[model samples]
Target: MREVMGECLPDVVRARQKKAFGGVQGEWLRKYHKRAVYGLLRSASFKKREYWNHLALMRKADAFFAGEGENSFFLWQCINLELWFRKFID
Candidate 1:
């Protein structure tokens, strides 16, 4: 789509800077990492069978809140997996 736009647009338009889209959730999560810490810590699935290092999750959460975490997408995946297990698994 960007290529098509560049081709169709004038050289002047094409020369302008391009911005990356979609980081609203990442921004929000970073800003509100403290609020999410409790939920991450309360992971039942994460506690079972050592599938994931529970302490590592806490460290990641801490890193996120401290603005040192660069793996927002991975954190989100971990959260989703925990939620999914709670919702679907007996």
Candidate 2:
């Protein structure tokens, strides 16, 4: 797909990569990392933080897992935030 786009649309700066990568990542997270995602989001450290309401965040997480919307990016951000806290603050 990228190769075809790159060949046919030389001027189009390969923008499809972002969308493709995001799709792959979102699917990957749902299929392979669901447990890890839930574990991180539901961790004591994560919930104790004041940055977000625990219930609200859990609701969002559940919705994301339920395919409520295109919330993969949001969940990805939450995962990164949790990891960051673990690395630097926790």
Candidate 3:
């Protein structure tokens, strides 16, 4: 994801870059801006999924702990493991 973001950085910057001559931006510039915004929104959505998944896991862990013994330590460890896997997979 970082690599994708790094490659996208130039496209984002170029989309924002203004023309020096005639002070007028081209149609392609507007299109680039649209693409950049869409890319950013897509990235944000992907990140939000991670947050939501973690929240769901924490909720489940809480419920499990309430019924079972106080195994928060193990739950946290499992959460960490899952996060590690998600980071690589994502």
Candidate 4:
């Protein structure tokens, strides 16, 4: 494959390190879908869960929004879990 397309592809494109294909979910969560994500994360139903520390969750979320940390994976998991509960258990 490299031999066949290497001539047509730019050096950078052909020689670049491989990376896992990923979605912009983290960016979307932090930017485009911020309001909706925040709403779902902070909703009464979500906050009602005793396992999570509401204040800590908010602080963590604030940090993520402020670019103080890379907690997108954690936040994404939390959001998915909440959505799953709402869909199947709530």
Give lDDT tens digits, candidate 2, residues 1-90: 766777767655765445433456688888899999888877899888888787887898788789887788777887898889889997
Q: Candidate 4, residues 1-90: lDDT per residue as tens digits?
A: 767999999988888888997666779888787788789877998999876787788888889888997788888888888888889998
Q: Over the stretch 13-65, how does candidate 3's per-residue lDDT look in tens digits?
A: 64564656432232322333435423432443333654445455445544543
Candidate 4 segments exceeding 4 Å error? 1-23
lDDT (tens digit, per residue) of candidate 1 on 1-90: 658797788888787789787656577676666476456566565667256888877888778767785767777877777777768884
What shift in Å separates residue 82 of candidate 4 from its native position after superposition?
0.5
| Model 2 misplaced stretches (Cα beyond 4 Å) | 1-23
Q: Provide the lowest-lDDT 10-residue window in model 3.
A: 23-32
lDDT of predicted model 4 = 0.84
Deviation in angstroms for 11 in model 1?
A: 13
Which candidate wins on TM-score?
2
Per-prediction TM-score: 0.62, 0.71, 0.27, 0.70
- Candidate 2: worst-modelled 10 consecutive residues by lDDT: 15-24
Q: Which candidate order results from sorting by TM-score in descending order? A: 2, 4, 1, 3
lDDT of 4 at 55: 76
TM-score computed on alpha carbons, candidate 2:
0.71
Better of 2 and 3 by TM-score: 2
